[model samples]
Target: IVDRIDDNKDGYLTTEELKNWIKRVQKRYIYENVAKVWKDYDLNKDDKIAWEEYKQATYGYYLEEFQDATDQHSFKKMLPRDERRFKTADLDGDLAATREEFTAFLHPEEFEHMKNIVVLETLEDIDKNEDGFVDQDEYIADMFANEEGGPEPDWVITEREQFADFRDINKDGKMDKEEIQQWILPQDYDHALAEARHLVYESDVDKDQKLTKEEVLDNWNMFVGSQATNYGEDLTRNHDE
Candidate 1:
């Protein structure tokens, strides 16, 4: 519009802008991050950046984060899944994920591995600011957890208070890790390992194949699974009298 080449200002440029700086200039501006501010202000495309039809397009989240998903699954993941999923879930137009919507739908259980990596006490601790919700970054740090002093600091937490906090979901001081995991994510968890992470023996726990079975599932529910039967058996056998 500033260039006045479109003259009509119908949101899209004419052949002049297309054949010239339109593509080159738009890309340059987008890359420089100047256009990031006015991202949703497409001024023409109803606030959605349809890059393919564009000559140089100026919006999109960082794509590389999900590049691996594209290689293994579908290229459509290159864009935000929420953008599309939002329309389906919000077919009625309210802009929030409701309880009915939440229970009816589900977050991906793809990375069961994450649960093992993210411990219960660690999660409770991460809600440190006491926000009741934990973010991905807080989940990464062992901050919500005290270093396990009795034995493995990296793998476990030795603090009694911390462990107690794990069971006390409402911070009410009652249940336990098993109860917490059960009430939080899974709908009908029962067995000890029911809510644990499903880790492949070859890939994890026995990363170097040295730790005893007790050490494997001993850390968190996320790392233990039926698939890890051998590792679990080893752990159970270790406890045998």
Candidate 2:
């Protein structure tokens, strides 16, 4: 990814190169997420999601079973907000959201409410006991359920350790609202900004705000493992291929 963005082929990623790479990363993120949302919610196979279908999929069928007052309140509040969003996205007011509108509606950067909804849904799924928190067991079980049938992967074990170490900040062995927020959206986690800053910080050995091939090679592992680097694995694999 860094090499491709080094458009001048001068063995360095300048500010312009970093900016372009960030744009590509943002585009890829939006494209993949939009496709996933469409696939999951576009019921009736109409290539678009109508208001009713979206409501059914989001609000779920067992609304009455929401014994938790918080969950019930959240769901009720979400209904009108989602309705308004649907109407807003329905550019022609056709009571349906096309892929484009739905994509816009689901953009996490642009629509915070939608992002919250997504986060809440994720919490609900993982918080099986409905205790408004996710315990270590709950997290582990959810991960295993999503994976293919086999013994849990080593990565899952590592993730469990990470959750206990980083996510359970209070040492309570459970994740509450603040912890969950940290898990979902770590502080100052703007991927594009972080990536650009990290590339320059790691590779600009001369403090010139640009990378050279020698500098990048010197810190290759940083690019591969650092959260600040996007598409690093793909770039590595492409090089190998």
Runs in model 2 deviating more than 4 A are: 64-70, 111-198, 225-228, 231-241
Among all windows of ten consecutive residues in candidate 2, which has the lowest summed lDDT?
232-241
Which number leads on lDDT?
2
* Global lDDT scores for all candidate models: 0.36, 0.74
The true-versus-predicted C-alpha distance at residue 74 of model 1, in Å, is 7.3
Candidate 1 lDDT over 1-241, as tens digits, reads 1223233555433334323423343333333342443343333544433222121232233343445664535434423343443334333445433322321122222124333223343345555565555533343343434355344354334333444554445654443344545434554552222212222233245454233334433643533333222223333543221
lDDT of 2 by residue, 1-241 (tens): 5567688898778866776677766666677678877867888999989888888888886476778888898799778867866776567788888887787667644455454555665687799899999999898887676556777789888989988998899999899877887888776676667667877786778998898878877988876664325545455344421
In model 2, how many backbone clashes occur?
0
Reference-based TM-score of each model: 0.21, 0.57
| Model 1 ranges off by over 4 Å | 1-43, 47-80, 88-151, 154-164, 167-241
